[model samples]
Target chain A: MKLSRALGASVFAAILMTGGCDTVWHPSIPPVAGPAEFPTGQIARGAELAAIGDCSVCHTTEGSRPYASGRGVQTPFGVVYATNITPDPETGIGTWPESAFRRAMREGVDRDGRNLYPVFPYPHFTRATDRDIAALYAFLMTRPAVHADTPPNRLPFPLNQRFVLTGWDHLYLRPGAWQPDPAHDADWNRGAYLVEAVGHCGGCHTPRNVLGAETDGQALAGGEAENWYAPPLQAASPARQGWSVDSLTAYLRTGFDAGHGAAAGPMTAVTAELATVPAADVRAMAVYLTSMMPKPAPAPVVAHAGEDPVFAGACGGCHGPDAPMMRNGAPSLAMSTAVNAPTPRGTIQAILQGLPWREGQAAPYMPPFASVLTDAQIAELAAYLRSAYSDKPAWRDLPAEVARVRGAS
Target chain B: MIRLTVNGQQHEVDAEADTPLLYVLRDDLGLNGAKFGCGLGQCGACTVLVDGQPVFSCLTPVSVLAERQVRTIEGLGGNAVQRAFEDVQAAQCGYCIAGMVMRATALLEHNPHPHEDEIRAYMSGNLCRCGTHMRILEAVRQAAGQGVKP
Candidate 1:
């Protein structure tokens, strides 16, 4: 989702600059003089929505105060620093009224009526109900007010102009809350709202147009994040095993399933956040996401004795036939989503940046090979894995792909 | 039978192609310098040098080390790094000391004089449960100053 989000934002800039539409402006709401009071129940509900939204992952830096917001979100155009949403009177959104927050969520405008960038993902947030927005505002306002100034975004000339967002929003922004789908049951509708609005899964999963807006019909057809490929969740999913609602819930809630490996890269943080929300909500999401996928065909498992020294050495510890991890029921590489992915980017990335070791937590952990293996070595190993484990065709231009990913890292 | 060089001696060991070099070193060859802590490579207790690069021997299979040079703490007997560790008394309970020394040896071999930050990052893989890190860092610094043969 990282790369696609960047490309989407860059496309937004192009649309904004070229559209040459009217520069729409709204009168700024005078700063609320004091802290506004919200009900306890509303604050609690808002907390759930924020977790589902994964607000902290982007808005907070590692080991810093949450929502203090100096984290640099990467985009194709440049870096957009997540703004401080804490209730700090000086640097955060302490002065903003609920109306201002609603407008920002609905119209992609700030309290000052300045056009906020699309990197904030208002395109998805626009579909959220008014009650949810109020709840989010309450939750944000009640936070331990942290005072930290966000750095200026690093966009080139025309893209740097916030005014350009006005035109981009005109072209892409579909305002108003999501209406319940009459055909689908309440559970499905709830899942759809969470996925489209708060979860904003499409912000990363959905492929974007040249102008950076997500392609209308192709909702969860795979996309890119940072450098790793986010595999499709729809009919084109590369999953060798079919996803059931229960399995999807387990994967999203805990970041691992016996059939599929742990979530790596950007999705790791996502699953971590999802773990905090209600399991029922996650199950609902699983229900909706699984409905889109057709029954998976039995994955062809090939048995080629891997000859690559790197795989035998670096990977055999966990993945080899007699390895303890495999012996203890870890899934085979044949079941790996990345190995079956149409692109080699996911596999290459997993090798270079292995699953991290969480302290005191027992999970699937692999040491990073970015330092351990050379780019050429990584390419050779990736190819060896694909041929050995799956019946998929050998990935093309693997050396170039490895080089590109390593260079980006 | 997999043939590989260990501590300047070539040996043929009876093991599977995917058998971890750690088991071969400890179980077959009886060279126990590399411990089998968390056979999952997260702990660097099984660290050894493969072609001068540090790797978790528990994770590295003999199949990959066909003709490669594998050096263990047994090979570094009283070498500069060992001497430095001894001089600083950088061991507590001493379970993880061997792995720490091997990883530090590799780091020095690659970058003889690394910055404090670089040393911390390089040594992150090796876990020292005894918490004798301050002394271990001193030993590495001492070893870097004395300079050892590659």
Candidate 2:
């Protein structure tokens, strides 16, 4: 969904020139005129809040300036191209008054009264405190504006009907006001507020009813996020053997946790975003999540060696007995989500794609097996590694799985 | 010793404490319908019925199953969900079918008659990597005599 430069410019120009210029529409929250004034501290706080919201991850295109937008976010329904949020008067949100931004964030309604899709995660953002929202506004308004455009959303049929979202909003969307819970401690309440309102962990982890509203009875029983599965968050989950408050907070702060492996795919961005926030906030979130668990159980006892002949022959060199604790950041199978995943896709993916160089890191690299190993060999290695390191059952139809993944990639 | 009545027959399995039910069922009793996808309980491939409730066998320790009646896809045999699955050929790779079948059976048994939305919501936990989802939904619909979704 990467748009052509010329097309982006025009669409952006059109958005800036039309619709929202009407001040009579939103009379209640009068739009501020001239240069906006905000305290320096508010800007700094706003920067942190932006990271917590993970705004840049979804908005910015690869190799593009921050907040320039035009990145296409893929969803189950269709691709949602992010609009430019920079302060460019012609193509960005520079013309959007603070009132407009607040309305969009809190009410899921744009400046022109256009209903933004739930894909924007307004349901979560709505929970942010007014001061925090102000800080975000200050931070974004100060950014360098880029003249860019985004492609139009291409959802089929009723999904494309933006008005259909009015009903969805009626069912799921609720404008939020910060309400202090008098019972819990500040830390616990903060964690609860972030997880429920700000962080909106349930947006992905909570399974949804047919109408896409999260099933109330099952809060965090797991659901699909983008294409990746956001595993369950409650007690008796896989984390029973792996995740602790310290480890969970560490995983959230850094991309890696020794017992639970490194963050992969979409979660990497989330981890990176969390790393930018205050350490205490991350710990608070962890505390709240771990509290959901029944009790702490010792980590699973998985044997590391003498599991598979194929693994011993091919992978034992670097991931072997003598392998360094952190070799090019490749995680151990005993703690790797790849091997422990229910579907062979993650394991199959790692074997086929190897490890790519991260954005800023100069780390160890592994060669791809697309040409190096046969489908049968890859299958055998995957099965062996998963069985050896994990107490879980082995995935069936390994050869076919390898072939399918191989062909697709 | 853990006594489990799986697929109607009773078996006494000897294993260390906290060993997953999957290990005992497959390695000991030789009931292999539940495939191991993610041993972490992230995937529903290792699902079986523990007292008519679908549970992940890979994450469930045998110690938790002392008094529970365990039912696997093999136990269901020719039940409506299985027959409907067979009729529609709902499986692609046939790896996740057992788990899906077991979960579907549990849903039908729980509801007896479920709307399409109800079935979808209940079965959302189960995933098919082969993308046999639509056909699986159709199969469940057929199994419930709900007729194939137009």
Question: Among these predicted structures, which one has the highest DockQ?
Answer: 1
What are the models' TM-scores? Answer: 0.84, 0.63
Tens digits of per-residue lDDT, candidate 2, A1-409, equal 2333333343334434443334213333444444577889989988887887788887886668999988777765567888888888777777778878888888777766777878788877888877777788899998987888777997665566555565556556666676767877798788887777678788777887655567777877777555454677776355425567898898898877766766665677888889889998888888888888656666667875464544543455456656554464545677665676566776776667654445465333343444335677788778888778888788999999889877756
- Give the runs in model 2 whose Cα sits over 4 Å from its true position: A1-34, A178-183, A208-213, A304-309, A326-331, A362-378, A396-409, B1-150
Report the number of the highest-lDDT candidate.
Answer: 1
Each predicted complex: what DockQ? 0.36, 0.01
Return the lDDT, model 2, position A222: 72
Candidate 2 at A23: error in angstroms? 20
Q: A382, model 1: CA deviation in Å?
A: 1.4
Model 1: per-residue Cα lDDT over A1-409, one tens digit each: 4554664466566566656545566679888878889999999989999999999988998756999999887766679999999998789999998899998998889899888888788999999999999999999999999989999998776667777677677678888779889999888889989999989999889887765678888888998878788989888988888888988899999889878778998898888888888998999999889889867456456686735666776787688788898888788888899998899998999998898775556666778766556677788889888888777799999999999999886
Q: Model 2: clashing residue pairs?
A: A8-A149, A328-A364, A341-B38, A342-B37, A342-B38
